[model samples]
Target: MLKGKHEIMLKTSLGDITLVLDADSAPKTVTNFIELAKSGYYDGLTFHRVIPDFMIKGGDPNGNGTGGESIFGVSFEDEINADSYGLHKLKLGDATDEALPEELAEMTQKEYLEKQGYIFNDDLKSLPMEKGYIAMANSGPNTNGSQFFIIQRKAGTPWLEGKHTVFGKVTEGMDVVDAIANTEKGANDMPVEAVTFDVEVK
Candidate 1:
């Protein structure tokens, strides 16, 4: 197996894309990701969602945002508090003052509500979304599973910073991620072509 940080390379109609998984910050999520990759859970999967500012989501067994069963389900990982890990906020500026477009603003608020189950610290710190955030999608806290997303962009403010389970970040292959973001797609945001993936530990 590869050691330390590792890469999962793929061949998509959009070209080549590689994603680097961080083992340290998101041990469980990374382990699960590596396992799924090795099991070929991502083989022939297509990008299901492609909202430019949001993220490009895939890893579904059925090629739809809602598909994934056999090896695709994810149990609720622990809620990752940004402060607990001594992690600074990923948003920028006065975080309290900077205003973002409504669409993004709404998402930021929604992210906070999902994490309400956990107690929060009012003290603020500075952390960049680029630090290494692997955000999980969920109906509520401890409700996360296989489906996840990397923070391609930083949070607009700190109030919007908390609430997301950012288990890890990309240590390498940012170019690949950018490339995938730039790929052409169709339908409910599915990539026009297929995205097949395989994972292995180094």
Candidate 2:
């Protein structure tokens, strides 16, 4: 372990998530999220876009895709989710296999991680949203806003290898995360039942 890092436990309505904060790899990115998440900006928000077998997208405060920080506060100069870093992220077609059943996803993510070999258990302590990784929303490069997503199932979005800025991954409570993704959507792809969200970190 190079340095000591703190842990954050995000307790969502769907379930709970225990994540290790990465202060090195994506310092600015992490700082932005930690600040916003702790400030209660993401609380009570719904997963506006929930694709059952693909990914769940949300974080826009307005419940609309266009919702988020009006002013560009941070540059998505990401350390990961770039078009490089040599990652083989799942794509649309890859997610066809029953969507990895969110219940076992947290434990089964090892297989996906092993295939990429980017999963290092050392104490490098940095944001690595490799495979089954989580990332912020970006209309384009370095255009991340309040939106984010978790690759619940594998897909064929190889081009997405370095396109999205990945900041974290779902280590636990992936099943619940899946539940949120599986929720019925309305006309604008908004959750039918309004699957509310709340995060807690310990």
Q: What are the per-model numbers of colliding residue pairs?
A: 13, 11
Reference-based lDDT, residue 161, model 2: 52
Measured with C-alpha atoms, the lDDT of residue 70 in candidate 1 is 26
Could you tell me the TM-score of candidate 1? Answer: 0.63
Residue-wise C-alpha lDDT for candidate 2, range 1-202, written one tens digit per residue: 1123346665666677666655555555666777677788888887788877667777778787777862236434434532234333433235455665554344333345444432332222334434356777777645676787777665523445555656666666777767777877887767878766766544
What TM-score would you give candidate 2 relative to the actual structure?
0.68
The lDDT of each candidate is 0.52, 0.60
User: How much is the lDDT of residue 58 in candidate 1?
Assistant: 60
RMSD of each: 6.7, 10.2
What is the alpha-carbon lDDT for the whole of candidate 1?
0.52
Instruction: List the candidates' TM-scores in order.
Output: 0.63, 0.68
The CA lDDT at 130 in model 2 is 46
Best by lDDT: 2
